[model samples]
Target: MTVQEFIEFKIISFGDYFVTPLHIMQMVILIIVSWTIILISKQVVQRQINSGRFDKGRGKALFQILNYSIIVLTIIAGLDMVGVKITLLLAGSAALLVGVGLGLQQVFNDIVSGILLLFEGTVTVGDIIELNNIVGKVEKISIRTSKIETRDGIVIIVPNSKLVSDNVINWSHNRSVTRFRIKVGVAYGSDVSLVMKLLSDSALEHPEVVRTPEPKARFIDFGESSLDFELLFYSKRMFDIEFVRSDIRVKIDQKFRENNITIPFPQRDLHFKTSDTFSIDKTK
Candidate 1:
């Protein structure tokens, strides 16, 4: 072969053998770096959220933007290494892409709604939330979905669209204290005023109950045959709700026994009509 042709062949071979693998290695490194930044940023954001130091929405949104930006840059860098011009590729598919965009409307909605959720600061990591019947702590909020770890140790992934479209119960959104109501029934003849005093006192004595707002006992009504009293108190957290209610109930029972108040068991009266000719057939 001619000298120039031989040199050209060598250069082409060198480009394919060395340059390509080097590019792959570089892309791998870039991806690793981007992922590392995303993770670190998440931890930092979570710390700020749990500490109540800043608006959770703002912090999360900032981190999300940072994460996506880094990821996109990594992707673009990889594409550039392969000599695929992104601008030209996008321009070529601009029209067809518009059609695809219509099909992915829900996908875009979920992403946009997720951003709004983070920016609104209505929910945050470590916050207790009930979404689509999934109750748990906000573990991770991604662009399309947010993850929750329930009290029973189950992790759930709910689409951001669900959060936006449905009703969400955030127990620790504005404050840490969550209110729980206990309904108790007493015999109709029981003294109403005394029941109130007993319940309010019982709640105040419990350590889990909040004191500033003051424990409340409201006479809901005289149902079917008993006087219903509703006890309302703010618990330190929803996770402690069961323990608080159980303890308060024990306290109330004790107080009622001492004060001569009875928590009536539901009673139903029944009657039977029978003919005298009817008899049991034991032999059969």
Candidate 2:
């Protein structure tokens, strides 16, 4: 057979679809070109991130959008090369997609949530967030789910929909520093002024705690057992605030010990009333 005939010799044919040596070569070339484009895009994104041209979060979101767009475009191009009409294909699958959408409503919600999260820039990778009482640092934000790494070193995969629909506290959202409070109770009748000073000193001693706000000690309430005082402070280490608080507590406890300040526990007094039918015996 001639070279042209061999190139056009159909290896497989089904209805309107046919695969030949020429088609295989074209498919291979298309795949290689698509892969090269994706790689170049990734490199460009990495350079942008490293150069600090934009905020890391915003850059990452842009990169993801671009990457996905490229993949979609490449897929459409590949299908077109293989004699598949993009519009017609989508229209043909419209009813099937509708049926699938009903069953996969939650999955679709997560996808939309992911998109919103990227575009709105509400929650992003490396953000410290609280959801469902679980406080963790966002390790990754993907199309459908997010990976959160807690203080205990546990990584949890959370659905993106929960983040968008539910109430999530983004500690690192608007500000890098967040204010936190540690509640301390001392024995009643103890020196209130001294307690306040000690609490403030303990907070100020921590390196992570900010000083501009000037660690505050507030007399919040008079509890049943002791005098309730709250030590309020600001720190930039939202994810590691627990550790910072623990260090402050340790310092507070040591200072209190040295100052002979007593922390009280709950104490209750019970009295028994004796009636005519029930009298206490003196000698038993």
TM-score, each model?
Answer: 0.74, 0.89
lDDT of 1 by residue, 1-284 (tens): 77554433432244434334455566788888888988998998889878988666557767877778788888898778766778988999999999988999999999988877776766666688887676788888888998988878888888888877899998887786888889999987898999999999999998878897889999998788689999999878685477788999999999999988888878888898986796889999
Off by over 4 Å in 1: 1-52, 55-61, 77-85, 95-106, 269-284
Let me know the TM-score candidate 2 reaches against the reference structure.
Answer: 0.89
> RMSDs, each prediction?
5.9, 3.0
lDDT of 2 at 158: 94
For model 1, give the 10-residue run with minimal summed lDDT.
10-19
In terms of lDDT, the best-performing candidate is 2
* lDDT, candidates in the order shown: 0.81, 0.90
